[model samples]
Target: MTGQPLDAGTIAELPKVLLHDHLDGGVRPSTLLELSDAQGLVLPADDAEGLASWFVTSAAAGSLEAYLATFDRTLAVMQSADALRRIAREAVEDLAADGVVYAEQRYAPELHVSGGLEPQQVVDAVTEGVEEGVAAAAGAGRRIRVAQVLTAMRTGGNAADVARLALENRLRGVLGFDLAGAEAGHPPSRHAAAFRTLRYASFPVTVHAGEAAGAGSVAEALHIAGAIRIGHGVHVIDDVVLGEPTEDDPWGVEKARFGDIAHWVRDQQVPLEVCPTSNVHTGATPSIAQHPVTPLLRLGFAVTVNTDNRLMSGTSLTQELAALVEHAGWTRDDLRDVTLTAAWNGFIHHDERAELVEDVIIPGFTERSNGRHRA
Candidate 1:
């Protein structure tokens, strides 16, 4: 894969797979304004551009707790079934426009019950919206697949119930389960029973760990909570010990030694749903250039790039990849590798994942490069 660095336009045309996107966090600013107006709720900004800028500024508060506070506004208008359905449908449409071939939308159903909605009703509304979004995208000549991953807030007390909801809807559209929220005081181990239930039922689980905390948080997510994938697991790099660079290797990655947790993560090929821009905004990492995604990828840690929250970060998957190419000196091969990693690690069944990689992702990249690289 040798040529000029891929620009954002080229990256936007490549088929990509997303594994870690928040439904509430990705609501369109214009939609938010409309919903808030219908509810007679005051907002910091009156227009879409200002509202979008406000979210980006608020999310860059340099702490997970402060960064998460911006969601109060998004969640404020997302209480009713109609709002959830609209937001979910628009999310799929936006991703399709951005050239995402597959995506898994995640949100905590318990958060939407304040408007007198049952958890099952919330799921039904979102599922309906996803179906509609898929059909709409297909009509517009954009083929995409969207699935749901039911999330349980780590600080909330209803994780067990969320797990049950995921199992009940597995055949419908729910593909997996997740635990998200403040990762410091609320560890994944706190919801042991929820993990136990999901594990006993042979369900896939991904835990948000090693973001606000360190590698210890990642260990608990993997060992105690039985997560097959780690969300924002950048801090797993904390356990690595960097050694001196050798004459043959200037980057020193060959000399870097991994601790027990890091070794296990790499050895078992546990997928890391890394959000580069979101990590910078939340102070999880310093910047895109210094992000551990590159190093971890070089060390064979199964690193996959994602847009954790598209609106909050003021970004899309294309922009995320372009940033790596511009600031991190990433090449076309790096982009392909991460896209393939994400496709293979998606929550769907093994055969479906293979079809996505073989039929969609590889062909898209191959055609774009004009046979410059072989998959």
Candidate 2:
């Protein structure tokens, strides 16, 4: 293959790394129907396709609040350990099928404890499911690695407890901690205690900021909460200012300016876990063509594409890449760049990160390019 923009099929075959996926949000629609039926719960649609369409449409309701309300039905079906395990396992299988070599999926264990299981039990069940899924996929000739990121809802009071849970299970596939859910009024500072605890324990933390809010939310996530990666940080573009084109550079190439927050994020090499389809669904952008990904990538920000909620976005990592290829005009090299960035920023050990790049990513891309590897 030449150094050209990759088509959808070729893009699907390339190795990928995902850092911002959600376990609850990526549940299979068929699995949701099965779980709902087993629990005698009434769903908006009785069939899988209809249910999937419903989730996608409802999430496009133009506001983050409306977008998040769709999770109520999803969360309702996740009360049992068996349900959670199945969801986790199937998530791995789906991602592996899409050629994901590494993933760190997140979910709130506290949310799954409503049926009387302890938080630790929830973690163990999901971890077991991940391990089982990886083995099953490996049996079928697909190699993948998966880790868990325990999440604490920003509106809830169990963040510190969840942080401790993450530490307890660090050796058992738990990778890091995250603060998810509504981000407007429930700022990261609200969970300062949890951040302080995780910081003291030397645990890595990612915060959901600048999605439902503005750049200040990102600042609090960094300064107040000490987040290393930001989930859906599209709003950080609010801090970036672009000047009018001049005669010397008609596109204003050198006139783009970054505010203090954006400057810090870029200079510090902080990763922004950007989910293009999910961002459009949440009204962060009207469409993929209008997303700031192109400019952000050109501006040299550490941007890594992701599938934040596959079910909600009705997407796969491949679909996300394809959309960028078509709409944002991203090339094979651009996809490779972001995949490498994600692998580096992944919440794994340094040796594992190096191995992923040196072994899986580079080799896969090289094979796809017919041994004409990029320098």
Q: What is the lDDT of residue 145 in candidate 1?
A: 95
| Tens digits of per-residue lDDT for model 2, 162-221 | 999999999999989999988867987778888998899888999999888988898899
Model 1: residue 217 alpha-carbon error in angstroms = 0.9
**Candidate 2, superposed: residue stretches over 4 Å from native:** 245-253, 371-375
* Residue-level lDDT tens digits of model 1 in 1-375: 444589898888889889999999999999999999999999999999999999999999898888889989999998888999999999999999999999999999998998899999999999999999999999999989998999999889999999999999999999999999998788777789999999999999999999889999999999999999999999999999866767665446888998999999999999999999999999988999898887888788899999999989999999999999998888888999999999999989999999999999989998888844222
Model 1 whole-model lDDT (C-alpha atoms) = 0.91
* Global Cα RMSD, each model: 2.0, 2.3
Best-matching candidate per lDDT: 1
What lDDT does the true structure give each of the candidates?
0.91, 0.89
Error of 2 at 323 (Å): 0.2
Clashing pairs in 2: none
